[model samples]
Target: MSQTRSSAVFGKRKEPHTIIIAHGDDIRHFTVRPWMAALCGSVLAAIAIGYLLATSYLVLRDDLIGATVARQARLQQAYEDRISALRTQVDRITSRQLLDQRLMESKVAELLDRQEELSERNGRMLPLLEKAAGASAGSADIPIPSAKPEVRADIAPANAYAASAVTNSAVAALARITKGSTAGKAGSASIADRADLMFLTINKSLREIESRQLEKIRTLTENAYKTADTIVAALESAGLEIDATYGSSDAGGPLVPVTGAESFDSEVEELDEALSKLDSVRDAATKMPIANPAPGRVVTSGFGVRRDPLIGKPAFHAGIDFRASIGLPVHATGTGTVSKAGWNGGYGRMVEIDHGDGLTTRFAHLSEIKVTEGQAIEVGQLLGLAGSSGRSTGPHIHYEIRRDDKPLNPVKFLKAGKAIGTLL
Candidate 1:
């Protein structure tokens, strides 16, 4: 009978009693197809998997973006720092270069100023130096002092002496007249005669004194003229164009017409001015490069302390010795005045040049003297022929440099040879 009742369950279940399995308040349907359940489970599983994947993807993307941003920021900062460092380095280099350039410019300007100052000084001193040289060369032409005419008390030498004799004769006549007269007459005559004689004697004596004073004045005037003439001659020899004039006067009792003390003071002032100019010239010359005596690269001796070749002892070698042929031409090291151009004790035929500023140069042991004393010479000009003169053992040029009477090494002055050659 239960089987017959179960037969209706296929299409419709008429019995109203519904059996429902419930989890909490939810009902469970058992009629669902297995394929549908399986499909639904699969859909839910796919949805869960998709949600998890999406969350993971978002998180990874955020991390990657943050890392990229951080890396970009670091790179930007590094680039900025590098730019700043490069800018700083560039600025420092530019500043240093500028400083060096300015320094060089300043040095050049200073040198130019010094050169100008020296040139002005040379212009002033050259004339005075020439005058001195000329005076030194021809001092024999000066005239000797002349003896003055003598004036005697009783007898006169010239017109004044004759006048004095006449005055004595008049005095004797007055004495005779007084002796011949009587007591009262003689007294009056003697008094008048004596007065007349006294006047004549006084006039004669005054005339003699005045004449002597005039002669002395004339002599002094002549002497002053001669001295001025000598000075003018010396100046001419020193290559100076000087206009000199002499004036004399025989007035004011035996007054000698002379170049006054004030004139001498003026000359001293001129000398001081010239000396100052010379100092400036010398300073300028020191800064400039000088020429060399020898042309070739061969140098036999150097300036400074060395073992003496002759004595084999330590000594201060003041000059540079250049080995050359006997007749080799020696040149002036700088522009200067030939101060001494003759033989010396140990230097043989030597030449000394004053190159301003107390700087002097000497060329010794010369076979020939090309330049004369007081001659103005230029650098690289032929001076003389080299020879084994003085205490030398071979044909060479003994060149010495001096400053303010003290010897200095010639090599130091010759260092400007290269630059000098280029300039020339």
Candidate 2:
């Protein structure tokens, strides 16, 4: 084999590597270089290493991805928590601001309600104030509210409410109504203070109004008393006693201690009491027989001891004689029912009227009696025709006023009528 290999190499150094394989009917020779075989082995080893590395990477990929995802989730949760905390703080602040706004609005609304109440009270006091003002302006002549009550006619409570002036509180409340809840943080306190001041002013005005109204009511009550006293004096001067009463009341109840603004309400209550009392007095006075029976009449015979015309001697005159033409109408002196419309022995064709409170009047010397017995008559109504009848000196109406069957002087009532134009 060596002698053949050397002889083959000496003849040709370019030796082709060969492999001879024998088959049943064929023989084939294959040749390859050492470098080629090394190349094939190196390729196979690289492929095997690459396959193992790929399989290992596949096995670790899920765990690596899971760790990364978990870390990211933790970071995301932290960020979300921070964001939520911030949002909560903002919400809390907003809620607090909303609560403040609600409180402010509630305060404003309460103030408005108080202003409205004060305004309503002011309205209710207007008529009394007007009456008082008018009466005061007209008269230093009229001594007091009770002296000449005719100036202030009986006014209805409904007519009492009228606008005299727009108060500061009312204006402020009206302005605040348009500026609802728009106040800034610093402005909110300022608004509240201003509202309080306005409320104070309103309360002050109400107090003043109540005071004035109470004064007027006092005046009215005093006037009523004066009028009643005057009437009583007039009746007493004529020896007539009528049942009457003037009350002196002491107020007592649950004593509530008032302070600061609360006194305004108390004053208002007093004013209401005064008004009620004045109203009651007016009602009572309206029913009394305190007016003149004859207006624009000439008194010929005074009520006192006078010379009897028939006897021509000194005699006591029970009544005043009003000289009038025969057939002239004679008026009733007071409101009453006709008790007798027939002739008496001394007073022929006389018409007698029985006034309330045990009071009566006689129209004597009448040609004809217009009012029948049991017929109701008002003061100044035509009772009969004046004529010279039995016990009459001439054609005249012998007007007699009697209380409890006792004759009273008619001059006092006539003077009262002159003093009070309305009663006349």
lDDT tens digits by residue: candidate 2, 1-424: 0112335556745455667888988987777667887899999999999999999889999998999999999999999999999999677656645765565566556555545665665565565455344333223343563543343423322222321243433655645632653455455556556655665665566455545444445555455445445544544454444444544456789977775345545554554554444445434333345555455667788898988888989999998887688988787766778899998978999998877777777888889988789998876788878899887778887887777898887777666445443321
Candidate 1 lDDT over 1-424, as tens digits, reads 0111445458644333334578998976445445776899999999999999999989799898999999999999999999999999677655644543454344334434433433443344345444333222222244545465322211212333344454455445544543433333335445445545554554556445434534433433333344444433432342322333323335577755445334333443454453343333333443332567887837888888899888899988888888888999998877889999989977899999998767788999998999999898887789999998787778898988887878875554565344223212
Q: TM-score of every model?
A: 0.33, 0.58
Candidate 2 global TM-score: 0.58
Report the poorest 10 consecutive residues by lDDT, candidate 1.
Answer: 150-159
| Candidate 2 worst ten-residue window by lDDT | 155-164
- At residue 68, candidate 2 shows an lDDT of 97
Model 1 clashing residue pairs (backbone): 130-238, 156-161
- TM-score for candidate 1, please give it: 0.33
Instruction: List residue ranges in candidate 1 displaced over 4 A.
Output: 1-289
After superposition, candidate 2 runs with Cα above 4 Å error = 1-100, 115-245, 248-290, 420-424
